[model samples]
Target: MKNNRYLLLVLLMAVIFFSGCERILDTEGISRITSFPTFQMQGEEIVTVVKGGTFTDPGVTTVEGYPVTSSITGSAYIVPGKTQPTDVVYTSGAVDTNVPGIYIITYSSTNPDGFSGTTTRTVFVLDQQPDPAVDLSGSYASGTSPGATITKVADGVFYSSNAWGGGSTVVIPAYLICTDGVNVNVPQQESTVRIFGHGTVAANGTLNLLMSRPTFGPPPLIDLVKDWVKAN
Candidate 1:
C-alpha cells in the first residue's frame, strides 16, 4: 500500500510537471502574449495560433502589479518597444492528440493579491470522414501514427490528420469539460469507449461524450480514456 501511494504521488507529480509551458512577452509597454497550439498528426506537426494574456506589466517599477520589493539594479528590458518580462513557464507534459475528436484545456492562476483566473482551449482532431455520416461506432476510426492525412469524408475540401498505433484499443475517462471559451453541452451516450487508430477514430467502439449535446466548446473528448483501456 505504501508503495502504491508513493507511486500514485509520483504519477501525480509527473502529470503536473509535464503540462506544457507559458511565458510573458514583454513589449516595451508590456502589451500582449499569445500561446500557440502544438500537436503531431500523420508524422507531421500541426500548430494553430491562439490569443491569450491581456496582462499589463504593472510597470518597470512594479512586479506584475505590485511594486518590486527590491531593485535588481540590473535586468534591463530586452528591446526598446519590448523587454523580457518575468514569467513562469509550464514546459512539461505535451497533450496527447493521438486519438481524434475534441479536447479541452483548462488553466487557472492566482495573482499576488490572491486573485485567481482560469482559461481553456479546444483542439479538434480531424476525422477523414468529411461527409461524416451518422455512425454509432465513432468518427475518424482509421489512421497511421507517426501521423497520416486523409480527406475528410464529411467535408470534401477539408483534410483530416491523425497519428497511428498498432491497431490497439483506446479508452478515455469521464471528462466533465475541456476549454471554456466556446459554449456547448451534449450528454454522453455512455460512460466510456474504446478507440482504434491513433488519430482517426469512428463511433463503433464504446466511447465517451458530454451529458448534453454541445453545439460549441471543447470539441468533446475520449482519447485519454481510450489510451487508459489499452495500458490496463
Candidate 2:
C-alpha cells in the first residue's frame, strides 16, 4: 500500500510539473525541471487601423520559467532565481490596412529546456470609422453566468470585463467590435484563453452573444448562446 501511494504521489507531481512542457525532461531525476516560457504582449490584443493607414507592431516580452526558491537556483537545468526575459521571434498573418478585414500576429518563445509558449494579437483594418452614435456600454448578465461590464473604448469598439461570460473565475477580457449599431463580434484573440464569437444588440438593450471557446473544452460548442440582459 505504501509503495502504491508513493507511486501515485510521484505520478501526480510529474503531471503537475510537466503540464505545459513541450519536451520531455533531459534526465530521470527531478533536480532539473524546466518551467514553460511565456510571452506578454506590449499592447492591446486587438487594434484597428483605418484604410491606407500604417500599422506598427507594439512588440512583446518573453520570459523563461517561473522564479524558484534560492536552493533550486543552482540547478543547471533550471533558470536561475530570477526570471530571464528573452528576445522572441514571431510569425504573423499578413496585414493590409487598405483591405477591410482581420489579421492575426503570433509570438512564440522557447525556453532552454525546449518548452515553448505562444501568444497572438488581432488587427482589424477598417474602410471607415465606427459609428459613434451607437454605444453598448453597460453591465450585461446572462442566465448561466454572472455579469460582464461592457465599456466603449472607441466609437463602436467595446471591452468586456470578463471574457467567458461573467461568472468565470479567471477575469480575462474580450473585445467586441460593432461596425453597425446592431451587429457585434468578438475577434479571435487569446486572453490566456482563445475566443471567437458574434451576436447582436436588441432594440430593448439586450445583448445576445454566441461565444465559441475551444479553450473551454468539450464537444466543440457551435450553437451555444448567452442572452445578456443590460442592467443600467
Candidate 3:
C-alpha cells in the first residue's frame, strides 16, 4: 500500500508542474498582444494633377485591434523620378506641379508603442493646355526697319527674331496666359540674354509689348514699350 501511495504522489506532482508551465505561457502570449498597435491608410491610392496646379490630399487612419488605445500621427512626403521635389506640404505636394512626371507619395504613421506603418500613392502631373488667343506663328512688323519673324518650333514654343533691334535675330520663348479666351497675355523671354517682355493682344491684331531687363540696382536698367501689328 505504501508503494502505491508513493506512485500516486509522483503523478500528482507531474500534473501540477505542467499546469503551472501552461499558465506561464498563456500570460506571456497575452502580454505580447497588447504591446503593439495597428495602422493603415483609408483613401485613394492614385491621383493626377495638371502642371502648375494644386493637389488635394485624401487622408489616412489608424486601427488598433488590441485592448490598448493610442494616438497615431502621420506625414506625407514626395519622391520624384528625375528632378527634386519642391513646395512640399503636410499631405499634398508629392509631385512638382511645375514639372511633368510620375511621382510617388509615401504616407507613414507611428504610435507611442514604437510601432509604425507605411503606405504609398502615385501621382501623375500632366502637361498644360495651349492658349488659343495668343498665336505667335506668323510674321510681325513694329514701326519699320526689319520686321520680326516667328515660327512655331514645338508645342508651347516659338522661334523669333528682331527682339533687341539692330536687325539682330534671336530665339524668343513665349507662354500664353488666357483668362476666358477673350483676355490674353503673352509673356516672352529671349534665350540668349536676360530680356523679358509681356504683351497684351487686342481684337485688331495689335500686340502692345512692355519689355524690361533686370539690373543689380533697385529698378530695372531698361524698360521700353512698343506696338506691333501682324504682317501678311
Assess each prediction's global lDDT (C-alpha) against the native.
Answer: 0.27, 0.63, 0.49
Per-residue lDDT of model 2, residues 75-100, tens digit only = 01111122121211112445666654
Give per-residue lDDT, candidate 3, residue 204: 71
What candidate 2 gets wrong by more than 4 Å, as runs, is 1-47, 51-93, 98-123, 166-172
RMSD of 2: 17.8
Provide TM-scores for the models. 0.21, 0.53, 0.36
Off by over 4 Å in 3: 1-50, 53-128, 132-134, 154-156, 164-190, 215-219
Clashing pairs in 2: none
Candidate with the larger TM-score of 2 and 3: 2
216 Cα displacement, candidate 2 (Å): 2.8
Residue 61, model 3, lDDT: 52
For model 1, the run of ten residues with the poorest summed lDDT: 70-79
Cα-lDDT of candidate 1: 0.27
- Expressed as tens digits, the lDDT of each residue in 112-176 for candidate 1 is 54554443433333223223332221233321222223332222112223222223332222211
lDDT score for candidate 2 against the true structure: 0.63
Best by TM-score: 2
lDDT of 3 by residue, 1-232 (tens): 9999999999999999999999998887566543243545555565556678987655555575423222222122122221111222223344566764445565565566667666666554545564434456677777653676766433343445655332224333333333222333332222454444445566776556654444213454333565657675
